[model samples]
Target chain A: MVDSVIQTKDLTKKYGEFVAVDGLNLEVQAGEVFGLLGPNGAGKTTTILMILGLTEPTAGSVRVLGLDPARQPLSVKSRVGYLPDQVGFYDELTARENLTYIARLNGIPDSQIDRRVDEALARVGLEKVAYKRAGTFSRGMRQRLGLADVLVKQPQLIIMDEPTSGLDPEASHEFLEMILDLKKEGITILLSSHLLYQVQAVCDRVGLFSQGKMVLEGTVENLAQRVLGGAYRVLVDVESVQPEIAQALEKIPGVAHVQVTDTKKYQVEAAHDIRPEAAQAVISAGGRLLGLGVQAQSLDDIYTAYFQGGSI
Target chain B: MTEAMAQKPAMPDERAVAALREREGSPWTGIWSVILKEMADHLSSTRIFILEVLILLAALGTVYVASQNIQQTTAEDQFLYLRLFTTAQQPLPAFVGLLAFFIPLVAIALVFDAINGEFSRRTMSRILAQPIYRDALLMGKFLAALFTLALVCTAIWLLIFGLGILRLGVAPGGEEVGRGLLFLVATIFYGGIWLALGLVFSVVFRQSATAALASIAVWLFFTVFWGMIAGVAAQTLSPIRIGLPDEFLAQANMELALSRFSPNTLYAETMVALLRPEIRSLGILLPTQLEGAILGAPLPLSQSLLLVWPQMTGLVAASILLFALGYVLFQRQEIRA
Candidate 1:
């Protein structure tokens, strides 16, 4: 068995009958970039709070590095780095000064703080404005500064909640590359995000969370096999708006769901390659099939299905 | 905002280094971090700068006026040094009275957003997640506020002392300096009570404005309306008829005790005792109770301190109690941004 760096058993958090997290069980190996994939109000933040020992679980246990965070949170916290959603820095402090404060908070000695802060700033590519106060930073720069803060801690595990949220695609791409680079360093990364495209690129394993419950958990490929069941999306762009074509395709045995994107375009979800059947049905239903392609069901479908009270 | 967003393109920072926390530092690593960070923040904040400037100007103006009055009245006066604290010009209070008012503003400025501002700025969770205990964080904030209070008060005290020496051409006597230092300490303690109140309100309310308003409201109630309320309460509690001196005395004594509950009253009484050494007791002593007492003799420094010892203790106790309450509430709260 691999060494699990974090484990939780039946972790439940209830705020006066509003259960934020319900009977959640989880395990992460020492160097896995795990993602808690969920929408808002799905208990992603609440679960992370419990794991961080900042919030007490109503009824459960959480262990990080084989130590109970509830009893010895200081040890767990000291060993784990956390970059919260919309991380904040002292606005008046320079980038270097902010990292220096974090270094000191992480118990890095005075002698090493300067060298480490410079390295962190250069790593995050903020060394140019290292002396600039955080108040002058843009949102993207602030986010990177938050990353610098986490790096200054040099913890074994780093947890980020919605790291790419509110970021432009370019910055989010760069951020993911950084996470992957961190993974290459063998540091465990547990991040939460609603964007499947973002998490799928870097996460080794994912826990699909919804309404305070762990609806599914596995490697992306494993989850794809388990929930999608070899399902593929057949995109058909027809020449004309065809309502009966989608209904006829839905009547096909393997086709499970069909979405009419527009009068000339629609998508079909099926358990197998339904492209030929979809094209035949569209043609027979008085529509010209201009183009058809067999596509695997993307992570978007999985989230929609899982959130709409269906596991698949 | 756009300038920040339009920052120049640069090569990304390196990422493949600095692994694993060494975990060798002491548990108290974050105290100095929080203290220094917040101390710098407090000092540089516009709110503090404005209030600090206002307080210094007020202190200097009042001291200058009081010194001019002292210079005019008595050139060979005994206890001329102590008069710097108590002497007032026409239409102006003494320097110590000025402190009793300004210290609250300084303390409130130092700490009105101690807890909730962190939550609003989204820094509380990150700070608390550090290796240090919550105790260190709370203690650090309080210690920093106290340090700021001590700094401001000591600077003002020195300025007053210097001004007095230049005006009177003599240094403060030993007893007067001792009493002045004690007064400064008591003033700090008095400021601590308001700082703690601000901290408690900050913890209780999430919005910074509400916390600030709440602290100010409490300060106003205690410093201004509390005496009137206590007097009314005493009268309501014990009514006196004509020629019933005993009942009147009981009413006055009850009023004194009730007013003592206010930190301002405690602080003011303590200052009066320290600056005016002829005062013996707070209670109204009858002729029989004052047997063999010297009417106008100055009290020793030790006797003056002893006279106001309970008031000092009350201020310190109130500050501690409020701080402890804030600490406990902060501990129990879920650290969410």
Candidate 2:
């Protein structure tokens, strides 16, 4: 039986009448990247805070590494590193110093700290600017340093809240790669973010959250399929527009619509792979097919559908 | 990532063993870590450097003028070594007066931003997320700031003593040295009250600038204005009848007790009682009460401590009260940016 690194049973958090996280039950295995997808005020951060034992749950229980986070937060915190949203460091301190401070907080002995600090900084690609004050670093670099802060402890579990929220595209890519590397090293990761593509890139499983409720949870592939037979899209290049083809494509069973992109292109969405039939339909409709290819349903589509209070 | 997730979990009882190990480690997980980090930050910061230098120069300048003027022997020829604290030149106040005025400034500066600045800079949540309990972080900040204040005050005291020895050529008697050390401890405790007050403001106010202003405003009220206000309040609360010593006595004692509510007045009283041991009483005494008192006779160090014991305890109680307020508020605070 594989024990989950983090298990929350009907976790709920309420501030006065406002429920921040409502009856959230979640489990993450010992070594996987789990993304929590949510919009602002979706209680993602509140749930994360409860898991880290930073805040107490109004109801239910949390077990991190099989230890009750509320009763034994030190044990849980010592092993489960957290990277808060918009994570910050001691701006006046150098990256090395900041890491050193966190390493000490983890009770890493002074003799081992220097080596660990160097390793963490290097791992985050901050070795070149290790001595620079964190205040001088760009927002992207600071986010990288937040990663280093989490890694410096050599934790068994790492939780990052919107870890790449402020990073540029290239930096976000590197950050996601770092998350993958940490997962490869057997660190359980739970990251919460609204950036669908970034979360899809690295997260093994994801939970869609809305207004403090876990609306859906599954592997991205599983969700894509389960939501709407994983709605497949077809990009069709035609020699000319068929005035009737768009309506005919829509008339096909399970096809939502066929959008015309010029006189020569049409995009189709269907509940299943319909590219071949789409091409045949185009031919029968007297349109010369230049190209046709099937596309998978993206996380964005499922996410949008979920937020719209409907299934894809 | 999928392959890693597919890997088997750890041995069934590994978590139990880890829990046992965590329980066995020392509970004081991060006191030294917080203290060292904060201490380095305090000592290296330019703001602290400027405050220390400012107080040092102002104190040195005043002590220098006083030492230059108070050279003649008095009829009593008593507490010559003690004159370092009490003697004032034509323009400059005594060392104690300068300290009574300046130490709060230094202390308030050190602590007004201690907690809120961490929140504003977004380090509070990260630091508290460590294995250490909330108690350690709050304690570490208090101790570090207290340690810094002690260091600054001790340096100033030593410099003044050194200057006294060089200029007056009179080595302090052992008793006088003991009294001076007690005065130094008292001064730090006094600074501690302001430090705790500043920390309380920091905890209550999210903005560092607001905390700083609130702390300084409170200190100013107590240091410069509270005594007068307390006097007026006491008079309004306890009106006196003409030619009735008991009524006047009631009014005077009321005023004195009300003023002692301010740490500045308590500290000034303690400094005066300890540094000027020849002073025998703090309260307004009836003529009959002064009959047994030998004029200008220096009290023993033990007697001096006895006289100011309540003041010392008051300073300590105020510090602990302020710190408790700050600590409770800090613990209740949600560590979010």
Candidate 3:
């Protein structure tokens, strides 16, 4: 069993009468890439702020690395690195100077600051423009600089809110690779993103939050299976006619429906794995099978199923 | 067999280990870092450097021209060395007066936006996320601005001293030098009061431009317009009839008391005390039979200082009070950015 790195029990944050985060209980395990998947106004940012001790939680406790963020924020912050959804930087300083300043604030030794700064810049592929003022940097470069600021400290747990919210596809792919690289170094990363495909690609586990509560928490595969129901799709290509193939496949146990598109193509819906028996029946019926594949549910399907139904 | 036997090492519980390694220390480290950065930026800016050099040269040139004019016309060197080194006697009291006014304005301009600009740039939230506390941030900023002002004042002071030695061909007496140092301290305190006032406005106002505008407005009101308005108001509202001695006395006291309220008046009065070392009372003295008899006797320096102690304390206390209020506002403010 993996030990939990971050645990929030009955955590709630209220702004006036509006409950921004309502009794959120979350457990992020050590060395896992956890994604907080949510739509706008889902309180994901608010939750991250509470965990960082930026915003006070109205009720309950948040423990990061077994330290209460509210009571011992310095300890939690010293160990964790955070990249806010909207990146803000000092425009007067160059990228190198900015990273050096952040490194100093993180308590790195003066002798080691330059080396760490160079390493961080290199990690983000920003060494070429490191000496240029950040004000002149493009949005993508600024985002990369913000990532370097986090990476310079070599923080154990990195919390990024909407890490790829505004990135182009190529930048997003590069960022995902960096995140995976960090994960490989045994760093725990918790990121919030609206892009389900991006989350599906990198996250080891995910928590789907909606209406200020965690609606679902599991691995991507588990969430897809649980929320999308047991409907399995099987696509096949036949060598010859399939009008009788559909009728014969429909008669198989646990097979719900069968539809033939062309003389060689057919889609079968089943409650279980009936592919073997269906293939055998199709062959016996003189329909030679050309190809066979199982269709798994996508993240979009799981997202739509949970949100549209208002429950997981 | 090799694949079956291969195993990963135990992951060192990062969060737990980091918690164990946490140390206790002052939270002001990050704030000092910001203050250092602000000072370095201001000091390194080309615009500020040019302004400083221009102001310094202008002041020295004015003093030099005034001394030369006095020597050419009057053939008396009494006001020569004094005017060169100090603002004791000059054709342009307004120039010296503007020096007192503009130095504070410039210092305040350098720091008024120190905190608010960070917020406007949205960097305050990022910095505040570090281990530093709010008080540390404010105090660090105050110190940085104070240090910068001190540097400017010191530079100007040394330049004047150098000019005096070169032009006069004699070093100043200990008393004269002592008075000059006191003037420098008073100038710093005066400038600091404005710096604190500017920071207070910065905290109270959301926009940096608004804070700066408010500071300049207050400076203009006190330095340029307030005294004129007070004089006019006194003339219009005077209940004392023109002919009576008692009326004159009452009006004189009222004017003297009211003058102390403005920082400009307070500073001027303090400079007068330091320069003259006589005129024990700021209030006007009634003409008497003994007035003509004791005109030659100068008051002792100790008595002179004691006479002005209340006014000096009031001005310094006002500065301190403004600074304390600024500190309190900064500490209580939420770091929203």
Best by TM-score: 2
For candidate 3, lDDT tens digit of each residue in B156-244?
Answer: 87777777666666666665666567666777777777888888888888899999999899888888788777766665566576669
lDDT of each residue in B110-199, candidate 1, tens digit only: 898898988998988788777787777888999899998898789888988998889878777887888889989999999999999999
Give the residue spans of candidate 1 off by over 4 A: A231-294, B1-29, B72-75
- For candidate 2, state the interface root-mean-square deviation in angstroms to 1 decimal: 3.6
Quote fnat for model 1: 0.62
- TM-scores for all predictions: 0.89, 0.93, 0.82
Worst 10 residues of 2 chain A by lDDT: A224-233
Tens digits of per-residue lDDT, candidate 1, A1-312, equal: 348988998999999989999999999998899999988999999999889878889987787888767666777887898999999887878888878877887778899999888888888899899999898998888989989888887889999999999999989998999999899999999999999988888998999988899989987766765676646778899887757887888898877677878455787777778887888898889988799987765677667656664755
lDDT of 2: 0.85
RMSD of 1: 10.0
Using TM-score, rank the candidates from best to worst.
2, 1, 3
Q: What does the lDDT read for residue B226 in candidate 1?
A: 94
What's the ranking of the predictions by lDDT, best on top?
2, 1, 3
lDDT of 1: 0.85
Flag regions of model 2 displaced more than 4 Å.
Answer: A243-264, A284-286, A309-312, B1-27, B74-78
Whole-model lDDT per candidate: 0.85, 0.85, 0.77
Candidate 3 chain B: worst-modelled 10 consecutive residues by lDDT? B73-82
